[model samples]
Target: MNQWLIVPVAIPAMIAAVLVLAMRTSMTTQRAISVAATAAQLAAAIGLFVLASDGESRAYFLGHWPAPFGIVLVLDRLSATMLLLTSVVASGVVLAAIREWDTRGRHFHALFQFQLLGINGAFLTGDVFNLFVFFEVLLIASYGLMLHGGGPRRLKAGFHYVAINLIGSTVFLFAVGTIYAVTGTLNMADLAVKVPQVAAGNEALLSAGALLLFTVFAIKSAMVPLHWWLAPTYGSTSPAAAALFALMTKVGAYSIIRVYTLIFGADAGALAGIAQPWILTLAVVTLIMGTIGVLAARSLPDLICYSLIASMGTLLIAVGLASAEGLAAALYYAVQSTVTSSALFLLAGLIARGGEGRAPPLPHGTLVIGLYFLLAIASVGMPPLAGFLGKLLILDAARTSAHIAVAWSAILITSLLLILGFARFGIQTFWNRPRSDGAAVQPLPFALTAVIAGMVAALAALSVFAGPMMDNMTAMAEQLIATQGYIRAVLPPAATAGLVGG
Candidate 1:
């Protein structure tokens, strides 16, 4: 077992514990510790990604315990990529938060670190039960973070967020329970071996379990009908907290790719293609709703929230295809969407901080408007940014699918709507806005500005290196479709002998 596999989770857990115990009263100390810890986590995640890119799958068994019997953490290209995404987004959000949000409430740093611990753990865990555990951990921390700013709006939104996720969590447990009841194993690798061997009579029950599990992920991903909670919850939270949450939807997307591909993919006999049609129909609806939401948005934060929904809809188009090309494209879009959405969230906070009612013209009017234009272009899938490339990949991948016309038309039309809508927003909020009456023109925090700018620069770099990035995503997608290497790495040969014998 490689030691580096656990570093992403362990480092954050340790740092969070220290902050809670020793530095809760020291905002400066908490900020310094958090920044250093996130930077280190980013380093670890990058190292894991490099190793995974070499096409080898690695699994770490806790306390030297073997798979199906003990806790296991696996690092493959997809999971590694998610880890890297989380760490990078976290670093920027932490910097933005430390400027002011961190000092506004108790244990902000501690909760933030714990949140990372849950997210990283979710990415690495190999068992369904532990995935649920990590989900709870992250949710608990998020509950605290959502309420950190202490406004009536924040409290109201936080309550809804908590209630909805609690319900989702309950559903998740039931899904896991159903899976375990039928498969007799919760370890994902073990499930890959056991699912195909399920008795013919039990196939329906197993499929139900899988679909139930997907519903939990869909809610987390904010799929329509299940997506209504997102805009209000995210729109009302403090900017830094909401920005950090930009990666949360990807966690749901990631889980769908992992579980769906590994356990219920083409190799799973009766279960193969069970979810394809459902996902496709749901994805189209999701896309439409996202566009509608954007058109209806009353404020900048609300617009970005709708844009995130649209982005997730775009990502699911690839997932619905359930092919190597489709999954690869989805993965690419996932990265681009996560980073861009987070940057927009932070930028929105900077533009108008305290209340969402209206932003008095910012002191750095030119800079704020400039950043808004860049983010708007990037988020709406304009050319030369990663968002454009992401949509192109999805479009190209969708061309061979039966729904090509629908996918192309929806994406293109929505892109236009988004551009028009954002243009209107830009005019009202920045160009034609009334100046603040007697308001102080405080300069934007240097750290906050630098972090947002860095995110934009990173987006540019991703575009410049699109070819190599897509190549890696293609490999990761191939790995996802082929589960043999992943299963072999987690379970012993004898444990899978029955699966192979079949």
Candidate 2:
């Protein structure tokens, strides 16, 4: 087991406890501690990413117990990629919050750290049961962050967010219980071994359990019918929290990819590739509807929320392909979208500071306009930006699919719709500004501008490094699909070889 595999989860857990119990009173100390911890997380994630590049899947078992009997944390190309992404985004959000958003509520820093714990935990956990535990941990912390500033509107939205997630939690438990009953194990690698050997008599029960888990991830991913919760929930939260919440939905998407590719993949006997049929159809609808939402949005925040939904639509379409090509595209797109969307949210916070209604002229308005221009074209997947490359890769990967025409048509049409929607918002926000009545134009603080600009710069860096990044993602997808390697990393060969009749 690699020792550093535990750093992502353990460091955040320790720091969060300290913030609550040790630095409870001093906001300055809290800020310092949170930033230090986030920096450490980023450093650790970078090291792990480099280590994982060698194509090895590693596991760290809790209490030194072997798999199928104790909790285990697995790290591989997929998890390592996500860990690095989460750390980068979290580091930016913490800095963004420090300027103003942190002072809005008590324990904001604490909740922030806890959510990191959950997000990182979800990525690192190798057992289905512990994944659910991390899901709840993140959700619980998000509840506090969602309602941080405290208003009637925020409170109302937070209630709906909490209620639906509670339902998701209930369904998740039911799924876990059903799976455990059938396979007699919750460790994912164990399931990878046992799921293929499940008796025909029990296939239906196992399929039901698997679909139920998909439902939970779908809701978390904000897929179609379940996507309604996002606009209201995100629209009401503060920008800093909303920026961080960007990964919350991605976790659901991640779980779907991880579980389906491992347990119910092509080798799973009668239950092979079950999610294959539904992924494309729902993804097309999600793309169309989400872009339409972007077109119809009345506020900057609403537009961003809907745009995120639309981006997820684009992402899942790639994932649904289930080929090395498609999965690789999905991985690349996921990284760009996360960074782009978080940056957009932070920019929205800057715009929102101008107060309600049409945007008013402010100091450094020219620079803000320039940032919006770059992000808008990127968001709409225009030329030379990372988003454009991501979509192009997805389109190229779809060529071998049975649904090629449909996939191509939906993506092409929605790209136009997204362009129109973002164009309208850009004109409205930067061009059709309200008349100023000699209002003092206070310049944006240096720290806030630096953080948002840094995020935008990361997107540019992604574009520049697309060749190497796509190559890496292709390998990661291959790594993800090879269940034998992943299983061996968790369970000994003797244990796996003896599981012929498990």
Candidate 3:
């Protein structure tokens, strides 16, 4: 049962390799294999979630190798939640891709599976080095997926995306090297024990390395100053690709929460709260910028991308609080944003149909308009949707913070701005603009529409289940704050003594 921890990463890798070997075969075969593999992964993820949700953490050391010396995969509530989220979104994206996007180019199924492999690996790995390795794997897969449909727009965006991430990766390597030099271990649990014990002379060096590592996550999370690459990169990609890319940002958020709380929490002596001020300021700025971008967006895709930035901003605000309440809210909001953003991206594609400006009204214009409205409400945090509850929780979590007023003001104003922006978009696209003349419009495929509707239903269900979900999130947050569980799960008892330089 413990070995099943690796199944999420392993199954996709095996499927991707098989797909590559049979590359010459029909896409039907590839699609069948890819979908089946993802389904199995989702099941595995669900199982992991159930096991970990009880406030217990589990770790698997590969080949029975000792902890810190061999690769280890740890599944706590946080990782399990992330894995489940990835699999759910991947499942939806895969269904949408099958509706024509899969055949647009060669190796779509293979790349997609590899992308999942990387994402799952990132979520499960218990070591800094393998985390970086998984980042590269997912990124390499994304570069291909981003250019799947192939156009000057996509090529240009992909170039910028690759270039920016390459820089981030280089910085990540340097940060890892610095930490390894300081602590003599790359295992996160060991780092938790060792980081605080770093000699006084190395304090500044440790802090700098940790900050540099966070800079990488900041870029990935699209935090204000480092966020420019997101809009263009996500905006120009194929809708299916963009929809799947939704979880990519959360990967950064997850890494930030996981590492910061585990390795640099209040226990980390001098490093404690070092990142708090910067993260809070960045989160505020990100919220403001994302709202402005949404208001200024000229296309549905751009709106969705900017909305993603804003959602990240909201998620980060909770993260900045650095408390159990805040982390719980952050986890809840993380799920809401991931699902909402992915749904909107997928819907934006069907509505836009790859054209510019606004998506022209198809024959089923009313239904499309309705779907847009539902997603827009969810995105803007209006009532009866998960977004509203998420915002409320974040605000409540930050009630004692010095910047509570500012957080509330930003969230409220941004919500209104988002509502107005999406309203204008709907009016222009559905009411004001005439249909494109001399163009043939095909009704969206049942599978495609079904996928979108399914996501909307999921959002509704998230609202319905918010109570129990938040309970789980609260439990998860508590487990995270008590880092001893994670540490014990990853490091052997005798080896643990070495955490303090003994």
Clashes of each: 0, 0, 0
Each candidate's lDDT (Cα)? Answer: 0.88, 0.90, 0.90
Give the winner by lDDT: 1 or 2.
Answer: 2
Score residue 279 of candidate 2 by CA lDDT: 72
Write candidate 2's Cα lDDT for 241-268 as tens digits: 9999999988988998999899988778
Candidate 2: clashing pairs of residues: none
How well does each candidate superpose onto the true structure, as a TM-score? 0.97, 0.98, 0.97
lDDT of 3 by residue, 261-316 (tens): 99988788888867878888899899989999999998888999999999999999
Candidate 3: TM-score? 0.97
Best by TM-score: 2
What residue runs in model 3 are displaced by over 4 Å at the alpha carbon? Answer: 354-360, 435-441, 497-502
Off by over 4 Å in 1: 354-359, 435-439, 498-502
Q: Model 1: per-residue lDDT, tens digit, 346-389?
A: 98888776344354556666887888898888889998889999
